[model samples]
Target: MTDILVSEIMNRLNSLFPSVSSELNSINDYTFLIAVLLSAQTKDKRVNIVTKELFKVASTPVQMLELGLDKLKEYIKTIGLYNNKANNIINLSKILIEQYNAEVPLDRDQLELLPGIGRKSANVILNKICNAPYIAVDTHVARVSKRLEFTKNTKVNKIEEDLYKVIPSEYHTIASNLLVMHGRYTCTAKNPKCSKCILKDICNSRNKYF
Candidate 1:
């Protein structure tokens, strides 16, 4: 049952979203990480809007360090938690420069050790930046997993474990992006687009129909 469901979900999401790249392509690696960090409690659309200007000013660790805390805050003032996030960005930039030679570490452990990055953010970097097999379970991914009965747990780490238990490693990236996108657009929190959902037939969600 898990195998069949996973296969179907992958097909449907892949058909709708052929690729999940190009989201942070415009920015350098350091700026991309900053954008992802700033994305917490914020929308990607908003992040894009702010990053367009922020990246133009500081696209690297040294550049970001030179941008200063107040100026950094000003650039990302539109984002939620801008104050704290700006602090993390500055401190992390300093650490990256001092420790990692100003390069974003590819290792999850090293990356997580940096400020403004946790397990989920590290996982996202691992999957997207390093092309590693990691599925970062955000709120949308967790909701979709529960609704589909793909994961019985509500905790992000537990849900991620459940997904890894059943899902093949090769499909991790696609699966994560697909589930996140699906929950965002189709199987949303309110009034899910059941009629248009390809996985509706297989979905065990209680709120299937509008």
Candidate 2:
């Protein structure tokens, strides 16, 4: 996409969702990291619901370890992949306490080394917590990018790379959040509100309803 088109897209999305940010509730950085970890393949609203009780008992790495796997599972059982997620949470908390001085690492590589954190999760932590310039690609971001013709790539990593080439660095921090919010509420998987979209005129998707 051209710079002018990218700017117009960004401007419209920012206007539509001006205060777009992470919806996952957390008490602190540690809880935020844990919340993001649990959000894989699950909605942020669901993760927030689970974390409401979970964080009350265990908000830190040490406290999370004390919560133990069984109790942790009980707290997050409503979320998908709870069993594995519980295990990863407990294990990652242990690593944080032991290796990182009970702190979530700012480094993407170190964050990725954790049991549940992959590139996408690591990118989120880095961008939101550490103020690093990285576009964390989730299903929403990928869908919006393709629909906008920012990229034809299907793989998350390649799409991310393509987005970096098209979108300026100054907009990287809010890019994913804007796209995610748009895809979640407007350009949804089915029956997208094309008629109401500001970018409907520029949208290249063949599936535009209008």
Q: List the candidates' TM-scores in order.
A: 0.95, 0.97
Candidate 2 on 1-210: residue-level lDDT in tens? 689999899998999889878888988889999999999999999999999999999999999988899999999999999999999999999999899999988898899999999999999888888677899999999998999989999999999999999997788989999999999998898888988888888887744555
Q: How many residue pairs clash in model 2? A: 0
Regions of model 2 farther than 4 Å from truth: none
Residue 87 of model 1 has an lDDT of 95
Q: On residues 94-139, what C-alpha lDDT tens digit does candidate 1 reach at each position?
A: 9999998998899988988988899988887777877788888888
User: In model 2, which residue pairs have backbone atoms overlapping below 3 Å?
Assistant: none
Q: lDDT winner among the candidates?
A: 2
In order, the Cα lDDT scores of the candidates are 0.83, 0.90
